[model samples]
Target: MTDILDSTAAGTTRGAVSSLFPATIGRFEAPEDRALIDGLSRWVEQHFREQLGQRPSCHVYVETLPAEIVALIDRLRDSPVIRELIVRQVPAGSGFEPMKHTDELYISHYNKDRGGDQGLFDRHYDGNLRFLSSSMVVRALIYLQSDASYKVVFGDSRVEKAFTTYDFGLLDFHRELHWVEGNYTPGGPQRILLKCNYLVTAPGAGARGRFALAANTAVFYVVKAAMEYSKSPRTPAQKAVGHLCNLFRRLNIVHPLVPLAAIAASAIGVAVLAYVVVTP
Candidate 1:
């Protein structure tokens, strides 16, 4: 099978620099592969049907994916063109190295529904290592089928972009405020998106960058816990915790530090509880 970059697709690929941030977002038509697209569409339909039912979306880990899908992702991650695109966006004299391993790769499925804002995501920055600056992370989306929905991005200005079957788009995680829109038609087509994230580090960042990565790795467990609470909060306390996390998620767009403060408060509360339990 031809690699994604090897396709003879007719359209020109392009990248746009954000006016307000040291970042870039772009879209390009992916290589035409009918069988591959069909396979992914089928997988999304079946997986969501049996696993998530009417749920708007679900994340399927990379390791659990079929061999072909994994191969495609591997090819995309290692693509030299993609690497060059990312490198061009970084500041001059800064190092640009894409990490070899990532735990943030997943297939996201937006299941079909009868309109209204039920399955759409709201304006929010893509989640990344909160400690790292926004310019250090890259996010990619590969659409598997055509849909009427639009991916709206807000940087210095508002821009709405549409994706068709096999469209590849990249985003500056944490720098771009983005969300999905226009999926409200009754019984609209389901959207299948393959999402991937990469971490970039300047060599000069050195020990501090390593420390940030390690800290973020540990924090990912907390994030998973919050996701579980949000998904299925069985008790009153759990429900409250879920609501607080949701609030933080929304407030994060106002300023990244807002979520950091929330995390700090939660940590302090836990520490106080521990101290009370252990004290004589």
Candidate 2:
């Protein structure tokens, strides 16, 4: 997936610096291989089976759908929107989660029991570590839960400070806490949801499982920011783009789902960065 770099796709519309968004937000690019999804789904299956061993119910995402969706995500990773939206939007580094992170994080469900925490639970997700590591640019996490009995609870990092969910007390990793929740799957299994696209999982989106939490219930998205949130001035074209973006969003037309939203957001992100580069 990381193979397709700075290279632009076929249908992406081009605009000069002052006229685009910094990055893609809603979906991955197109022309991706469906088999890739299949492979990933299988990888998720095996990953859980072998690693978690207990097989605590999860969902699997194939390639064709999300792979394409994440591609646009990767594109956004390199855009100028990252600078404008994140850097100018917030503190220089206030918005970062972990404050700093390494590369990828790996978890073994089998350790849940062996790790002294029972090794398996229906509620919550395995993405605790990943989410914590999101202090860097932006971060997209995919949750492939067991599609059985589980729920992803999201709350403010402050609120979560008072209570605990996944029993991280037994965890030996870093101690920085994230704000989230968990629950058991009472839907009698067979319950699954795939959030193919849409990034920026900030607060207010919801603190519950509107998302599918299963075996392959992975949260996938990209991040190109490492600053705090802020308020900034918008140029005429910038405001126009923002206005159009709002229109599309009201229509429930974000890309990967709505092609244009993805395009507009990405172009706008790039433009944001380009504007910053030449202005001062």
* Candidate number achieving the greatest lDDT relative to the actual structure: 1
| Candidate 2 per-residue lDDT over residues 32-150, each given as its tens digit | 42243334445544544553343332222333334654454333333333323333322221222211111222232221211112222222222222222212123333222233233
Model 1 earns a TM-score of 0.70
What value does the lDDT take at residue 66 in candidate 2?
Answer: 48
Clashing pairs in 1: none
Per-candidate RMSD, Å: 6.6, 21.5
Error of 2 at 76 (Å): 11
Of the candidates shown, which would achieve the greatest TM-score relative to the real structure? 1
lDDT of each: 0.54, 0.28
TM-score of each: 0.70, 0.27
| Candidate 1: segments with Cα more than 4 A from true spot | 1-35, 46-49, 92-120, 128-135, 215-221, 232-238, 273-280
